[model samples]
Target: SLDGASDNETKSESGVPEVPVPADDTPEVLNKALSGLSSRWKNWWVRGILTPAMISFFFIIIYLGPMVLMMIVLCIQIKCFHEIITIGYSVYHSYHLPWFRTLSWYFLLCVNYFFYGETVTDYFFTLVQREEPLRILSKYHRFISFALYLTGFCMFVLSLVKKHYRLQFYMFGWTHVTLLIVVTQSHLIIHNLFEGMIWFIVPISCVICNDIMAYMFGFFFGRTPLIKLSPKKTWEGFIGGFFATIVFGILLSYVMSGYRFFVCPVEFNNDSNSFTVDCKPSELFQLQDYGLPPVLQSITVKLYPFQIHSIALSAFASIMGPFGGFFASGFKRAFKIKDFANTIPGHGGIMDRFDCQYLMATFVNVYIASFIRGPNPSKVIQQLLALRPDQQLHIFNSLKAHLTEKGLLPLLEEAA
Candidate 1:
């Protein structure tokens, strides 16, 4: 009776309750059993485990995360460099790079323009074709990029000369570009694996997974060698962590998503005739889709990552990703700092957390671009109807209809 009462209490949707029916299957007992199981599982891992598990979960959301993440990364990179400079300023401080305080914005522009050129291009193309307010940026991204690179390069090369000790300027100014290339490409590649989340998130997931696993493995099984730099880490734990990534990657590839033609967690907003995902499905209801087709009307989620891709990519991240961490450790060893900074308990500095991601991004990016890019650049995945099927020719009409509805396109065009 208590079991029946409890079941009714839990599943009841309204204040008025219907009479409980006795059946061959004791639903009340089943409910009690499920509740007990849930209680046990909840007790199995407390907040410490749950918190990281959740971060690791979002860490998996990087397929469509670049637009937002790299922007966020702009801030993180500055803070990271700030931390590095505070710790290791002796090297570049003497060199005198013109470390612009607002460099993050400039860096973001370069990064966004470089990797997401297609969307950015189509966006502005739509804008100008429609005779919209902000339309000039569509025609000449390359020219602008080329000019910026040229000017920055000139400054960098000048710094290499004997008279120009502009090493700092050369390093950071160029460093910004270098970072833009490496990280953005890396993200693009990883993002391709699922096409739903942003690519940066995949590498970030692998790195965080490796970190958490290494810690758990080391904490419980502390006898073996995890790696050289991280003395406490054990090989047993490391292997275990790697397996965990494989499992999660495999599982995450199977989630419910409607936006990606070939990715995970991608939310399909049909208005733009392209696949893009924000943080969650709720964001689709925001002001962005006015001109776009409703996601339900035009979007649908298809196949998930089969065992092969998940196994391969996760394995790749597990093995090669660590090299990035090792490299960071080597850098740390050279400087002799224990942690990046005591920002998070148990977790070290953001750089320390992101070390593997920085490295893994390159590996992931190259693989994706190669796989997706066809013999003809324009024809890359051209056989697929998604990107190539657009009937909208005039850029302005498209922009006014597509981007202006989102309200973001106008702002980005104006800012650019």
Candidate 2:
């Protein structure tokens, strides 16, 4: 009876399970070009072609400088938010729900206003003080941001219909989660950029290098699976990518450290009415000699301190960054989707490409705050500039006294 019932169910069209389409997005030209190859090889070719294009786009963004890069990050964040929110809407089948989408976007604007306002107050204090309206905004930015968010909250509550109450709340939770993942992480990325492009670029490049190297190794020599969450991931790929990314990171850091434009923290220049990257290099960017180990005492080594830090960053990118991808994979599986969207040809969506990037951004931000960033002289100067003349004079006298007590004033005076 059981076998007969199983046969009947399998025979029924509605009972048949759906399988995910692996490479449904081949371009017409590529499709024809790869017609002679099997599906596996065709996918490899497609990814190989698109991967470099994405990296090239990244290079172009870097060439455009920090402002353009910031704009691009903002755009990607918004796109990722949209992709996630759209997925939530589709999952809940709440197309008919009123005001959820509007509220989601409104909250996004409020959050951006808050984060960017803080950034302006922190880094562009002179500009804010020069403009009366901006000064006023900066003075009460947090309160205004909270008020805006509250307004969105109230609107969301008012929009709730009786029958749609549960679904509406679920969407509310979904929107907040999306904001947490997309907006907050992107804000950290902008923060990392301000520290230096090296901070922003190096960790991100490590992740990218790992992703590419792992995929290449896996494609060619995968034998054992790495994780059940990502079936295609392999142990060989993991090991190979770790070493590759570490070496890539160290070498890249060495190259970037020599360029002041890449090493200097970005700051607003009051004289030029624009941003500048022209500060003297930090100790991290300076090369230092190290004595060799007992076994290799005959040899000497010189390296930028940043390169040593790169090993840690690269290790995290290779080891932990893939977990972000795995988490995304699990999420997609839960939703019964092959990809986030049909946005990128070989990649799934902008979010698909950026899921691990967001994780790397957060990590870099924390790493800078914890280990790299020091007492910022520019920030201290900015604060002093904002004070009354008497207060500034008081601070100057106090600093002089402190230096004199330490017996360093004579040396400073002589140098001056």
Candidate 3:
């Protein structure tokens, strides 16, 4: 079957195998049901049916809670990595290259171990400190990560063949680049998740809303092409998606901000031996009244601070997010292929669905660090708990003296 699949592949002008054009394997039942419709309408129907199914499944994951959602993100990350690497494999016709696939996966594991190790140390510091082996690993996490990466690097060097040096090195670079794109971005997504489910959900929801609204507008009113790479993209869609995403993001943030379950940061609960999302929500999620602009000075508006921030998130999603998709389109064109792989009936592969998401995740992470995140008191307390008793007492006295000088210590004591 492998041989048959390879034989069917198209060769490029350089004699390298091009990725095969993905066959439309729409389910037979859908095909029969839509047989009377034109191909254009048939495609719309297929995407319409499958997109909601995907969205519903996504909501179900969210409802199931963060742990399951995290597992799903990881699985999607792996799938996206596989799709990209598989393309590289076909393009280079490296099936005969010894251990190419194995090495790729090895590198993936090394990087994930490195990223997740840092995450555990940051979020689950207490749990990690309680376990001797985990404590050691966390302390030496960077060293361990570097050593693991070096092992893979050495293996790759050792596996290099005499005449196949160039091709092997190309594949090596390909593997690392894929890791940077898929793993690094997905890691950021998880980081955003721990901040709050809203951080994870609102941005993703904006992107999805933009994508759907863009398609709808373009299908009905496309006149000018937006880019040469993606012929189907139109300015009409771009503009429509932008406005729709902004409104959707604001509304979504408003609704979610009111719920403690959505606004609270995810933290580990040692007593329950599980993760928990319960806290006095930060001011970002609290409603505040604001005087209207000069144009409407007579009116006042009450809004969550996050809703104002959502405009930034949505603006980037609508305006710049499509670039990610365009970049993937250009990559596909270079390889002379259609979709990444028909993993989704009408949506190509998991990577196709996520190209823009990776970009949005990066933006959201940076945005939070820049604008929303403040010095976390919990983290400070955790660090204090890890210090020696004398050191903790020393810092405590310093803080108390400073607060007393500011005339706040007596007030705090009286309140207590």
Best by lDDT: 3
Q: CA lDDT, every prediction? A: 0.52, 0.87, 0.91
lDDT of 3: 0.91
Which is the winner by TM-score between candidate 1 and candidate 2?
2
Model 2 segments beyond 4 Å from truth? 1-23, 389-416
lDDT of 1 at 27: 33
Error of 2 at 152 (Å): 0.5
Question: What tens-digit string does per-residue lDDT give for candidate 3 at 237-352?
Answer: 99999999999999999999999889898899977879899999888989999889899999999999999999999999999899999999998888888888889997889999
Per-residue lDDT for 1-416 in model 1, tens only?
A: 54554454344323432222213222344445445456434333332544565576454544345454445555565556555544433333332335332343355456555545544444334434345443355456567766765665565445453333433444455446445544464444434443444344444565677667765765676688767876765788778888988886655544422344323334334357454545443232122222225855665443333433456667877788777777777766755555666554334565666667765666665655665334543223322322223533344467578877888887988899
Q: Rank the candidates by TM-score, best first.
A: 3, 2, 1
Kindly list the per-residue Cα lDDT of model 2 for residues 79-188, writing each as its tens digit. Answer: 99988888876665423678878898999999999998999899898899999999999999999999999999899988987555666787899899889889999999
> Which candidate has the top score in TM-score?
3
Runs in model 1 lying further than 4 Å from the true structure: 1-119, 122-135, 154-194, 198-204, 256-305, 370-416
Winner of 2 and 3 under lDDT: 3
Clashing pairs in model 2, backbone N/Cα/C closer than 3 A:
none
